[model samples]
Target: MSEILARLAAVEEENRQLRQEVEALRRDHADHRETVGREIASDRRRITALETPAPALREKTAEDHVNRLFSEMRRLNIRQTTAKDAARLLGVSKPLIDKLKPYLATDPRFLILRDPHHKQRHLIRLAGT
Candidate 1:
């Protein structure tokens, strides 16, 4: 009878140890799940940031185009050119040059003249020249 009681006590002790191990395993599993979930959320945030588009570029203003035209004319040593030629040199539409005509006429840095060779054409020149 005493031997049977001893065996029963040993079995009970092993069962208690197994329960402790199972509880430890459950805690470790919860921690692992929490870590994985956090990593997934971080990865999703990174993906969202990467997918967002950049802001649109700023459009060039008329003054900016005019400055570029003037710079090109000076660099090429052009004293005078017709509106059509100026538009071609500046890589802009003729209508844009037409829009700038009034401003160029009033500007102190430029001269507007009638082309002697072409009755229908106007010439643009630097003010000093």
Candidate 2:
């Protein structure tokens, strides 16, 4: 029947238009997903940068270890075999000796202070035996 054919053709045209709209929506969704992914990557890089602390903290920690051990050795009145004594023991800068002397107070066998009046001193002292 002619009426049946017209109805079928109208349905097919509507189906085709719906398919095109669905394809457009899919492309839009894909583009949005790409944009969101890029934003996530950029935010991740920013978070990583902010989470990381930039400092010579490790070197400073080494310095503190050297200071603590040097003071402990001095407080215990241990004899030094070499300038390398504290340097070798703490695995830190042997040159720290020169830098630390102004703060170094001693009684021949005693190390009196490892104070960095200009900086916060990280001191760990061992009780004398």
TM-score of each: 0.51, 0.46
- Cα error, candidate 1, residue 70 (Å): 1.3
Evaluate all candidate structures by whole-model CA lDDT and list the values in order. Answer: 0.84, 0.60
Candidate 2, 14-60: lDDT as tens digits? 99999999999999999999999999999999999999965533555
Q: Write the per-residue lDDT of candidate 1 for residues 1-129, one digit (tens) a residue.
A: 999999999999999999999999999999999999999999999999999975432234656766777788899989888899999998888877877777678777678899999898899998877
Scored against the true structure, residue 67 in model 1 reaches a CA lDDT of 73
* Candidate 1 weakest lDDT stretch, 10 residues: 54-63
User: Cα deviation of 103 in candidate 2 (Å)?
Assistant: 9.9
Best by TM-score: 1
